[model samples]
Target: MSTFDYAITRTLDAPADKVWQAWTIADDYGKWASAEEVVLDVRPGGAWSSVMVLPDGTRIPLSGSYVEVVENKRLVMGMDVPGRDEPVLMNLELAADGEATKITLSQTFDTAEDRDQAEQGSNFLLDSLTAHLAA
Candidate 1:
């Protein structure tokens, strides 16, 4: 099995702590993640789950467990994907940039096709995050 890794970095007009809250807090996550339900436990070994409503009205269930969590700094999690023997590892890092926050999101997949698709989805998600912050 080949490993395909994808990463994206973007700066948001919010502080690191605020950005962290947006990710770590269930209610805040639901607002930006297009999830009608969100359950987040932001700690190592903690579990998180959500039901994402797609544009076409498809509801996809996603669950993950945290591998590492550092307040306002980093979060690493393994996401369970259907039909996969292994979970995809996602790593997020945040840095304070004046009044803004710089976030880098990385994920490892089994194929380039998956990686490419994830990249596009991630960009859309980040855009949603930006809009959420602005609101």
Candidate 2:
């Protein structure tokens, strides 16, 4: 099995609390998550949904379950893409850095292909989030 790791860091102008709220609050999350169709149930065992609209307008649905959550600190979830037999674990970390916040999103999978796909997808979403947070 192959493994891959990818990380992106953004210095948000807002404080850590604001950035944490942006991630935990449903309305704020939808604004930055980048999927045309998105849903977030932020509690443990809550369900989440995201439909990414491709450049050609094709909608890709992603569904998942939140397995763990720590207020203002971390979020752990299991994500399942269409046609994928196994769910991938998603771990998000939030930290305060002076007036800025450092957020980390990591995905671990059983296979290399899964890890690769996750890196690409997370990169795209993180880029969108950076723009959103900056604005």
Candidate 3:
């Protein structure tokens, strides 16, 4: 099984701590994650899950386990996506940029098609996060 990588970076207008909370805290995560339900245990070896309801009402279930966690700095997880034989490695890094936060999200996928498909959804997630922060 060959793997490919996809990454997206965004500088958010919120502090690193706040951005970290928005991601680690279940409530804040659900606000921008486009998921109907969210469960997060933010520690190494902890578990997380979410059910995302699509625009047409299709529900997709996603689950993962934390591989590494660094408060306000970095997080690494293995995400179990539907129709995939293996979990994808997702790495998130946060850095303080003045009063704001710079986030770099990278995901490893099984194929270039998978990487391309995820790029759109990942962008939407970031856009949603930006809006959620502004609110």
Candidate 4:
């Protein structure tokens, strides 16, 4: 655990492959991921961007790239947020938990404030993912 890092774990009632698809595929990602418009190139070093639309129609743009990608197992990405000088590194790990999949999400930021702010959004995004997977 780094100085400015946070981890969240969730058990989703879906296979790892399905969860991976939800995270990587553009259309599937739009259903969750807390973004209205999403562009994802899931391969290593590929481009990743999305616009999260607020209820008031405000769009917050996020850009990033896949630092490491392991299909159905793990994904690590460098995510750029506004006001951050460096990209935040996000690691998502998936493993089998009987009929469900266990997802552990970790994010490393430059400062504690940045990490705390990002943590809120991460929780919302994962909650969205949980609903999407159940549906």
Best by lDDT: 1
**Residue 17 lDDT (model 2):** 77
Q: On a 0 to 100 scale, what is the lDDT of residue 15 in model 3? A: 94
In order, the Cα lDDT scores of the candidates are: 0.92, 0.77, 0.89, 0.88
TM-score of 1: 0.95
> In candidate 2, residue 132 scores what lDDT?
83
Candidate 4 structure, TM-score to reference: 0.91
Instruction: Give the alpha carbon lDDT tens digit for every residue of 21-103 in model 4.
Output: 99999999987866866899999989999988866788888889999999999999998767778777899999988779999
Error of 3 at 74 (Å): 0.4
What value of lDDT does candidate 3 attain over all alpha carbons?
0.89
**Candidate closer to the true structure by lDDT (higher is better), 1 or 4:** 1
Q: How well is each residue in 10-94 modelled by candidate 3, as lDDT tens digits?
A: 9999999999999899988887888867999999999999998777889999899999999999999888877778678788999
- Deviation of model 3 at 47, angstroms: 0.4
Give the winner by TM-score: 1 or 3: 1
Tens-place lDDT digits, model 1, residues 56-99: 99999999899999999999988998888877888889999999
State TM-scores per candidate.
0.95, 0.82, 0.92, 0.91
Spell out the clash pairs found in candidate 2.
Answer: none
Candidate 1's C-alpha runs over 4 A off are none
